[model samples]
Target: MIDNTIFNDKKVAFHTLGCKLNFAETSAIGKQLTDEGFAKVKTGEQADICIINTCSVTDTADHKCRQAINRLNRQHPDAIMIVTGCYAQLKPEEVAAIDGVDLVLGANEKFNVLEYIQKLDGTEKSEIHRSEIKRVREFKPSCSRDDRTRYFLKVQDGCDYFCTYCTIPYARGRSRNATIPETVAMAMQAVEAGAKEIVLSGVNIGDFGKSTGESFFDLVKALDTIPADVRFRISSIEPNLLTDEIITYISTSHRFMPHFHIPLQSGTNEVLQLMKRKYNRELFAHKVELIKSLLPHAFIGVDVIVGVRGETDELFEQSCRFIDSLDISQLHVFTYSERAGTKMLDIEYTVSLNERKRRSNVLHSLSEKKTKAFYQNQVGNTYPVLWESRHNGEFMVGFSSNYVKVERQYDKKLVNTIQIVTLGEWNDDKSALIGV
Candidate 1:
């Protein structure tokens, strides 16, 4: 029998290894553990229990998860180690087979972690509680308090669209979400907890309210009415679901920042069709144009995946040229990595590792140029920037309303507060705008 008294003075730490959605869920789990009498600590701190929220979007992610487990087990051999999240849901048996893992929970099972722990009886083998993905139909609202300056509020969960180079639908289940009223209440709660910014995040947030006869636009409209002094930012949305009305509404909203992160996996129409993406290159370009026309100072970030199957050199060139033509601020380039059971695995004409790295480097250089040009444009303009807690040497860093990073001398009074400052020349690194 396990000693129940051990829980009275146990410390627990959590480490999340995925998107903002995963971080939000991990924070919710941490809050639950805290409510249940477990003292929360940093990931590297000594703890009686350690929780790893894993991600399996790429093979490298899986390898990192394994390395973290091995490292944690070596450092804390007597700790009760638990692993959960997408990697745990998709491959419970594989994760359980890893030495030093005490329990493995799936997408639906992670929420019931306390119940599962109560049933454990000092078992030597790793306990697995994964269920079929189809059975995960409930929507659990979560928000990350990992940072006092911002919180990632999970307004939606799961995905109905199974893009060819994706395993999120299989890992997180179908599209579902809470009602607009419920989500607004959650946002209010976050504001009460001292959140300066709340990022609306999810697997496929554009598909929000599909199960409740509502729409993503409706959710945002409701949230805009919240009487909190917090700025709201959408994490990412599908081009097809990012309607013109939503863009126009946000353009006029006081609380919503002038920033949008849209994923355009490929700029070539043929590659997009191969990836089963919903929108074409033309439609994506039109969306960018619309956002630029409405919110002239908007910060637009594009997500591009390089080196996917069927992406020939010619197609990659076409993609690079098309991205170069866009009036966006920055690019988040992801080198495509094959995942097990994804539709892309069966597709022919895969790009080699060396070629993938080459394409990724080209995009990275382009991203730097685009970001630098965007920063240069804001050199003379004054904007309201919300300062974060972290500082670099004597400088404090923050992001403007349009997501421009600004730095000033460190001041404790400026933390978590929005200040209006005129932008000056870029620093030596040119990574951030400095206050004049």
Candidate 2:
């Protein structure tokens, strides 16, 4: 049996990889440990425990996990190294094979890391316990810590869609959503704790209602009942699942922000079909048009992949043209990186590094233009902004309802409070809004 006494007043460090969801979960875990008397320490410092939250989205991500583990071992050779998250969930054996990893906890067991560590405290052999993710029931609650205005509330978990290029379905299992009442309770708790805005996050937020028979629209309506002070933002959603009813509801809701991020892997029908995406370019464009027609000043973000297999120069140009024509506020450009177990790895088309970089730069340049134009249009408009902590020489910053970044003079009283501000000048150098 392991000893729990070793954890008293112990210091621990956490290293997280991948998505905002992972960051929020890590913060939650840190808070739990802190409440249990564990002190948070900086990475590379001497600590009793080191937790590495791994990601498996790309092969590079796996390499980064190994590197972090090695570096931590070098810094504190005697510390207990714990590996968790997507990479560890999918490949616990790989994580366990590392010389210094004392424990490996999979998806279902990650939340119980402290308990497992207590049990393993003086044990000679490390343990690897990973339950299959498909059997998990409870949704984990995650939110950003203090010192930030916007908190990420993960109301849903897992993905049922097995896209050819995605290993998330395997790592996260089927879709599981938190109960409507539980979600609202947590959201209210966050608001009471000084979170001015909450971003509803998950693996596939569009698939939130599959398990509960309630819809994503229902979640929005429930959140609409929240007192008028706090704003709610939706994270990424699939174009196919973003329905007209949801759009209409958001258009009429006061609490819901007019910012939407829809993933469009490819703009060409053939490329989208090869990628196993559910919707075609026409459907994606129609959604954009519908959102624009309803909320003209809404900030719309699009996700695009540059170097997927079977994407020729002509197809890439077509994708670029299609995005260029959209009324989107910005673009999130992701260069396709093949993962080991994904079906896309077996495909034949090869894109040169130069080509990938070239395509990515093209989209990024267009994104800058689009974002600047959007910000320019917001000049003279009034918006409710949730002021965040001061950064970059201590200038206070926040995000407007349309997702525009606004910067102003620091005020201790304004932190984490949503207040109406008139958009004044555009700081072209900083790519931010100057509010008055």
TM-score versus the correct structure, for each prediction: 0.97, 0.94
Best TM-score goes to which candidate? Answer: 1
lDDT of 2 by residue, 1-436 (tens): 3344566779998888888888888988888788777888864458888999989887778899999989888877888999999999888888898988999998888888878887785665668989887787667877775346678899889988788788898888889887888889989988888777889999999888888888888898999897747888999999999998999889988889999999998879988988889889999989999999999999999988888888999999998898889999999998888777788877798788789889999999999999989998999999988888766765778888898899888888887778899998876576688999
Model 1 TM-score, 2 decimals: 0.97
Full-model lDDT, candidate 2: 0.86
Best by lDDT: 1
User: How many clashes would you count in candidate 2?
Assistant: 0
lDDT of candidates 1 onward, in order: 0.90, 0.86
Off by over 4 Å in 2: 1-6, 42-45, 121-126
Model 2 pairs in collision: none
Q: Candidate 1: lDDT of 127? A: 93
